[model samples]
Target: MDATIEDPRLSTSVEVVFAKQHMPDLRGQVTLRAMAVSVVLGIVFCFVGMRIQLTTGLVPALNMPASVLCFFLLKSLVRLLQKGGFAVLPFTRQENMFLLTCVITCLNLAITGGFATALTGMTSTVAKTLADDPDPRDIVDNVPTGKWILFFFLIGMAGVLSNVPFNQVMIIDYKLLFPTGTVVGQLVNSFHTPEGAYVAKMQVMTIFKAFFGSFSWSIFQWFYTSGNGCGFQSFPSFGLGLYKRRFYFDFSATYIGLGMICPHIVNFGLLFGAIVSWGFLYPFLESKRGQWYETDSPSSLSGLNGYKVFISVALIVTDGLINFITLVTSAAINFYQIRQERDSSELTNYINKLHPSLNYDDRKRIEVFLANRIPVSGPVAGYIACAAISTVAIPAMFSQIKFYHVAMLYMAIPVVGFCNTYATGLTDWSVTPTYAKFVIFVLAAWIGRPGAVVASLLASGITMASLHVSSQAMQDLKSGYMTLTLPRAMVTGQLFGVALSSVVGPCIFLAFQNSTKPGAPVGSKQSNYPCPYAALYRAIGIIGMGGVKELPKYCIELCVISVCVTVAIDTAVLISQKRGWSIHSYIPSMTVIALPFFTGPFFAIDMCVGALLLLLWRRMEAGSAQLLSSSVAAGMICGEGLFTLPSVLLNMFKVLPPMCMKFLPGGQEVEVVDSFLNNSGASRA
Candidate 1:
């Protein structure tokens, strides 16, 4: 009997390999219980991801964390129900993958939506950063929660549907290695094996322990944050002088865990950026404050801060453009090659021959994968309907844009979606933000100010949400291919997940807006939520309208120099890679290096600490480090993130902490103590 053939009288070895599994279907996968689990976990991941996006301007990948938690929770549920004598559906790998897909879909939608960057850029919070007298008109009225929810759904669904046609091209035909998706696929499969299950159990235990400790630490830290510049968050571990430059280890579990997850180059790039901008560049620019600009105010765009914002923008925009061009060229070449190759060879046979390492079960998995196919027409029809609806509805929602603008945008989605997905598969990097920058500039220039900022942001939201969702969908599809799960099930899960997220993301953003002072003045020693990217996006919008010539003295010159430097570095790195030089990986990414210019160096310090700890652990015990690293990091990140909701509620209820603890110089400390004693004596008298 052929091992790949389905038969009732198969051999024992074949049976063992199949595990008596029927044709992979969505029966147990998309059950009510699965959706319930997905939604719950999805909400948690979304909250954490959104919080990170708003604060640090970076949202770490949550797919593995979601997978880990889903497996643990579902496995526990099945066991508990069985022990209680209740009839419970046995947990399966398909269900786990389904849940992971849903949770990750929801998470990506929440964090990648323009809420943290483009949308926030139009608010008064970010407006105050661009100019001392920002336009009241630029402070567009906030979209109502219900309206925002609808907007997200319309765009998000459109985005997800837009890429379904390419699943075959990216996942099957071309065989692009979506790194994260591959990791997730392998992870899902491993969790079903005996040894893998044991390791997963250990991972779950480590995660919970880290979660508890991190959550407790957050609670403890909250007690000392009664006043500004108080608590461990403000601790100047690098001493007061360097701390003033935003270089300090604040012991943040979230950032530290993120550091553990991120590559060393990312952490080093951040620290390098901070040192360059805050420690050296900013100080140098400030020394010429009297000579360069009239006012020394950090908040004014014409002052020292202008150099920071525009210079960072120059680096970001230049880097984005260079990478965008590079990716598009690569994708185009690959597409050409694929077309040429398809002319001479059968795709399935080619695929089979491509992976000689794949054993019989793996081959069988591929057979099961290709059996069920989603028709191309279905996605095309869906995409057209969405595009037509979005064209009409988006213009109605935002008066700055016309129906034709969106119609024009939709025409480009197919080409952009393909490129974005292709690039993502090749590099595991999404250039959606780069796409958004392009849209922002083009639309803002077209609309012209009074309404250009709002128009730019709204246009950016559409482009970004669409491209981001599409790439994520393709990534998930790759995972689906590997797991032998139905593509239709993946789409259904994503649809539900995104629908839930549309409402959840807006509500959370609204909650943060209502509960915290995100609109407070900039340049404070500390802020509840600085939303640095929001301000930077606003700067981009303003620059898009006014042109670079309006920037303060030497700002454009500095920007040009920064762009040239970034280009030179990128060129050097490319050359090194082509030459197969060992030093290429050690080179810091230009994008990561530019991030700290907006957010400051505080989180960078925390991340470096995490990376350092991971390095030492790896040196000590490579096996345990590899085993517990991600799980422990996930636990710590979730613990701190889960506490954010309660903290927000506490702030809302005026439940203030009782004490403020801060370190000061000896003379300042004595003065503060004397003042307190004097005030107390006065009260007693």
Candidate 2:
């Protein structure tokens, strides 16, 4: 390929020649069998994904890589059967990409549903904690089921619709790099060549082997370990008359995979927060405050919790402002450039200028292609209608909220969508939670104490879900653009996915909730699942609604300090970026900054281990590290995720005995021989 090309004609010619040489056999592209397989796998993966999130508080990406692997494995089986006197068809690359897109969309929805479940579950947990005489019934009764279902569907559809135009603008026109999506596109394109297919197949096999290894280990650890399903836990005493502080990592494959994908700076920042909160602040507070540290739990506060709350709030606010400003700045620069081009007739002259080697007809074809790719009127109208319906229906469904409140939320959707789209485009991190919290806070303040709680919760849920859906949709759109797939087909596949996931996700959440023990807080040992993210959001909602009066004095003080620190750090980074400093890339993202504050210190440690392993691997084997990392990391993730489904079921049904064995000095063992009693308690409670 040429390193430099200035003429549009030459660029078009190059792409045409390349396509002719590399295009895959398209016999099976976009067929009914492909759609069916995609839908089935999508539904199954979405259910499993939700289950994983609810149980472990980790969401797995079930997209191009995973889906492609699944497709080829199935294809291989079909080929084997055909050789054994049975006819079977092979899948095309385009069909695989389409199927992958569908699965990705569904996975996104499943995650959204899981988050919603966590949100509502945590709200109940919080309410119980706050109430003098807690009743789980009161909390459950208050949730309007019909209203929720309607709201979910409307918001989900609206999210899909609202993403289309932004997808076109950001992905097609501006060509923003959706990194993961780009990788998926490349993988799909590579399937055209035999070498690429062999590499992909090897990766698939590696992932399967890793999956089985991790899965088997999980069963042993969950059933046989002294901790009874818990990860490696340790309490190291500093011997300063302070109580031993708890520290442990959840040795799960999913988190390790996440570490592989995330930047080292992010993992380091998470570890940094954990060290500051648990290692330094917790110990220091124990010394000063004495018994207060001992009494405090993960959800409740000691001085450390107070500091975390304040710091998290500060980061959220600061990150939101910076994201908004960045979006506006980018827009302004683009507008200015476009204006200059139009004013100088540069754009038109450039368009009219043809390559000396090209004829007028070739130039006209290029012009027509560009014109055809622009957003059509039909899709624009459809999106507008969906948005309008959602805006009106949501407020009407819930009588507690005023119409104007919903109207304001509806108005903010487009703004939030654009900001989130741009933010993801620039940083590959969706700061939707920050934007959601900002919206919730504003709405809560406007609604006052009487309606503040409901307003904030509803606002946060809608904003978070919509933003998440739109961001993922745009990423898929980027993939579609790269693979030269029809936008309409991609949209239709996504809509099918959305429709199915909207129903499947909620059902899985409700079933999980019903099956689990009632009256237990989310993270408690007795509880069936832990939803750290939901708990974080719930805490934010409570603060937003109740205002500063609800916060402890220490928290307020720390919030002030956090503001100063966040501003200083952001300013320094901004200056560094302006000066073209490479170090700016190492700066921790808002997600990393906020993660340690909510989740346990162990998760940070687990992710750090994965990141460090990758770093070491890269150092030792620079050339092959890229391929090795993708296969191994993905295998580790998928292995744990796919296995969690059966493990959950086994635990639920009491098929596995609750027996614990200790190897450590202080560790003790518990053997529950009565299977009936164990199963009965879970069923009844």
Candidate 3:
């Protein structure tokens, strides 16, 4: 091949060697046998992982230490069985880098989780931080917000950031188990760096995207966690002074992505059952007068069953209903998305108009085509909102308790998040609309609910979605973005993410609840978007529609500054268009992000050091990335926040003891196998 003739491929067939690109292999080549097998394995792996995640709470740690360790060993075993005749965890240069990163990350988690626990213990009573609530000893008031500030900071460091090493090691650094027939290999991610200036934008956008998306979790956390609640603690409504919100309704955690997003709906199903059994069934099943004096309690209604039985029945009934709705909605969404994409008539319109803006070149044409297909804000979201509102309102209507509140609530949250630079990125705004920026400016003016808080929030969310689409478009146009291949397609993964997040949210919220605080709730559930905003808007809603005057000039100043910064970078990109700069070339300062998040007196900065070290290994040696990533996983298992620890510990005790008894030199169990083998049919004969 001549150098003048550009191949436009990663590497030519003959030139591809393990020395380059790490993936330089014949496996990637399209072959009848290899392709078929890859396809089958991919599909099977994906099927198992996705379905398991539906109810398993497995994903959180599956890609981490315990699982990572097991998988690595298995990978080694597979290699041993291969023609190479070597069985080893591919502790290539990359794996080493990954392990280093994990070591640092684990150190960080330990420091942060430990410090926070210690601080909480020392500053407050032990009963306060660890236990449920305060005693009935009639004590003095405490500083709730102060407690929460500490709580949230520590939790963020240990749970989210500190775990990055493990995540990178497990997912990015390894060949993941992906679904069949997908571009991503079986359980492994397949990502490519895009060409041109857009790459920088994509990289920056990813950081912000991840930050904003994950930060949104805080909204749900604000409601349920009394220790860190915005104002959702046991407010003295009934006048006893302290009440934990957990005892009321734990709606936030029902669906936050582990399960279905709406646990309450499922609970409502149980409520329905209660109505049937108590109102009708129990009335008829009364032994003579079983129905006559069966008061409010469920136990009394049932003839001789213990209260525990009733409680168990209630839980089962509620969980079932929630799961049923969740399953249906999830299926409907997936089907609708698939069908809408397949049957879209817009393709024809887009095809006809492609010539004007897009280059005739095949690559350019493909990019443009994908760009147009990216949906904008407001296509399906409004309907989804309307459905949610109607469902909530139907129950309210029957109960005669007006829920005009939620009607307005369903309208607002997204836009507010966008204005705060934390857009949910729910909607794809491939095309920006006129006056969108101005509307955002107006909405972002206030801190909370001005009379129509819901509308404002909805507008903000839609606007943010639109902006995200625009950002994606910019990256597409610029050609500098590094595309990320989440092993799981975002659509399905996002659905699962939402479900799990929502389900765990309420539990997290309840854990952090504290009466004395005022701010976003801790471990707040995102199931009900309003749960966070309700108190916030209630607090600052006085700013009103004419909030333009009330808006802090500083906030506006910050927005302007951000816009100016974005434009300056854009200008730089435009100047460098002819001779492109690697997207990283232009990003001058990560200092702002690094100080509070990466460094400072917070958690041990060792984790960030570890991550940075891994990055270094990527450049210095081949295969280092894989090595470092695996190491990180091992380190994390030995660190804080071990999600699947207990189960594995039990399994270890079960399997290890038996294995030790049999395999250890001079052990008692060696004779057992020997005796059993001797008693076999052949021996007996």
Candidate 4:
């Protein structure tokens, strides 16, 4: 086993806590203290995930950061105990992987459990403003934290349980490379070694420095905020004229950090989308306001609001429907090929064929992994129970969703789960949002108007949560396979994470919900917590129920034109891929392009700035840029996100800033103040 590693992705050597591969056993590895630490880390990530979900609706891969932090803290605790003359077991790679599994699962629920998206999409705050004649029964007054926690827990549990049977097929037989999972395994294994620990210490310190800087900056920005739209967040970085068009920077460290973490294509896509919709389409639509619709209310559905909501909806739904069909077809063909390949050979022989391709350390890892087999009956029974309960209880909780609807959704879960998971395995992207969009339109059309809004939103939540958890479980399974962690332990850690996040996710979401006027009249650039996708999701439900009738004049035609354009773009990319052309990567994604239309173009500028910084860093020193960019970016993101809850609390307590800084078109501050005072006096008189 003392041979050099063949694959560039695999580590050079293997190390474990005990001399033997499985000496400590699964029970000893998952101790009480490890779980306690996992919960603490889970809360921190919950805060970060909630911030991303509400602001940009773009969450980067967090497995690497989470694993790094886990190792740093645990190692520090062990050394401190040793210094105090207390005997403690050394931290192991297995323990770190277990903690990572728990933390990541919780973080996923916080982001994708639909608190900021579909759930808020069904609320009265978003619905009434967007739709002309929204149904009273379809719009929920509020979803309390307690009830939301229970709802998330039920759906989350079902998602976790449904993916257990596919482990052998995806991991052992198909031998798919979940790149994120592999990176996480390599990180965990490397950190436990003496050489790897030294490198981790440097990364941890770098992260802390970046985190402190970001946190301090946010605190500084808070002191100058005297009133509505009176802080650095509203700075007109790109001249006042463009700022009026919602194209100025918001001075957000979180967004800058997110830009660094997100791929370059995503950043460029947001910019391109912003320029297309806000810069051109919206302006033209506004010019035709009086002739096309009316000049009565500024927020009228037959005016700019219709153009903003329905046009974006048309692009999103068209993109989602096309991708859904393509992915399903691809999955069907792949499954058929696999079945045919297996017909002439035994499954074990197929699994053994993967052995020669791997290095010595990976071979050892595989050996240790297959020894601790997970039971099928446990997960089977668990899924059946959760499915049965959810089928009955979900409809009871939300009246719009009937027992038949829940039954139909549950039947479709396995197929959607497999397709999503398979696609995730190949490319490190989760298309749950696309699947959720398709579900929203289908269920809305099935149930018809009035009640369709509530039913579609609720059903999408259930579908998204389940598919997200299933794909994530498969990824973690691959990580476990590489790190030699017990499959049973990995499953248990996932469940524990679901339990913790069931409470944490809801509580954080409620804090944001109550703290800010989410889904209110405040536009995406003006509001601190705009929850952009919620508005988009609600608009989709409305469109699904009303069709072209709900749209303004010329809007439906524009929608059709946008659909055809998107189809042409996707077709071009596919053809380019088959012809060995490298041009497909340059093209922006359809789903990402639709995002900035709803959220406004301000953040796109911030993200591009971040990508520019990364480019500059790479130009200076490539190695340091690759290693420390994510760590520094994550620190900045977490630092600002950590302050979000506290900032909300400060707002709730009626704390006010001492000074107000105003920026006007002509720099006539005194005139503005005098005009404000005169208006106030006239109102009183």
Whole-model Cα lDDT of every candidate shown, in order:
0.81, 0.61, 0.27, 0.80
Q: Report the C-alpha lDDT of model 4 over 1-685, residue by residue, as the tens digit.
A: 2233345344445542333644557876686767888889999999998888787877788887898899998778778889999978767777788888999999988888887788877766676557556668778756667778888898889888888888877776677787888878887878877888888888888889999999999888888877777778778888788887888988888899989998899999999999998899888887886688874443446777877777788787778777767766776787677667766667655544535556556556556666676778888898888888888888888888998898888878877788888877876667788888878888888877688988999988999998999899889988888788888888888999899999999888767765553333322334576778887887677667764354578877887898999899988987898798999999988878999987889889999989999999999999999989989998998999898777778878887667666567765876887899899999999
lDDT tens digits, residues 1-685, model 2? 1112244444544234234433333344455666666666775676556755665454545564565564675467557777899655554555667777777777786677435433463355644433323333223334545555666676677677777766655763344677877777677767646777777777777777776787777666666533333323222222212222335554667677778766788778888876776777656655645443343443443334545555665765776677667665775676466446445544335333313344333343333334435376665687677667766786676544666776666667777787677667755667676667676667666766654655566777777777888888887776666566556656776777777677666655555555444455444423545565554554465565554343334556766776777777777788888899987787775646665665546667677888988999999998767875766776676666556456547647766546654223232322343455688888999
Off by over 4 Å in 3: 1-500, 512-563, 574-579, 583-608, 615-624, 630-638, 643-685
Q: Where does candidate 2 stray beyond 4 Å?
A: 1-29, 43-64, 70-90, 113-118, 128-150, 166-168, 225-244, 288-307, 339-375, 388-403, 511-528, 547-550, 662-685
Residue 636's C-alpha lDDT in candidate 2? 71
The TM-score between candidate 2 and the true structure equals 0.81
Name the better of 3 and 4 by TM-score.
4
Per-residue lDDT tens digits of candidate 3, residues 260-377?
1112222233333333334343334344343333323322212221221222222322333333343345445644554454355453333334323322232322332233232433
Q: TM-score of every model?
A: 0.94, 0.81, 0.30, 0.93
* Candidate that scores best on TM-score: 1
lDDT of 1 by residue, 1-685 (tens): 1235444244333224446665546777777777888778887888778777877888877787778888888888788879999996778787888888888888888887888888888877577667777777677656788889988998889888898888877876777999999898888878887877888899999999999999999999989988777889889898888888888888899999999999899998999999999888988887886788877666688887888888888888889888898888888897788777765667655665555444554456556656666898998998999899989888897787788889988999888888889989988989999999888888878877687888788888888988899999888888877777788888888898889899889988876666553434322224656776777777777777773345578887898899999999988888898899978799887888999987789999899999999999999999999989998899889899888788879988899888888877677788989899899999999
Instruction: Note the clash tally of each candidate.
Output: 0, 1, 90, 0
Candidate 1 error regions (>4 Å): 1-16, 345-363, 515-526, 547-549
Question: What would the TM-score be for candidate 4 when compared with the true structure?
Answer: 0.93
RMSD of each: 2.8, 6.2, 24.0, 3.6
lDDT of 1: 0.81
Worst 10 residues of 1 by lDDT: 517-526
State which candidate, 1 or 2, has the greater TM-score: 1
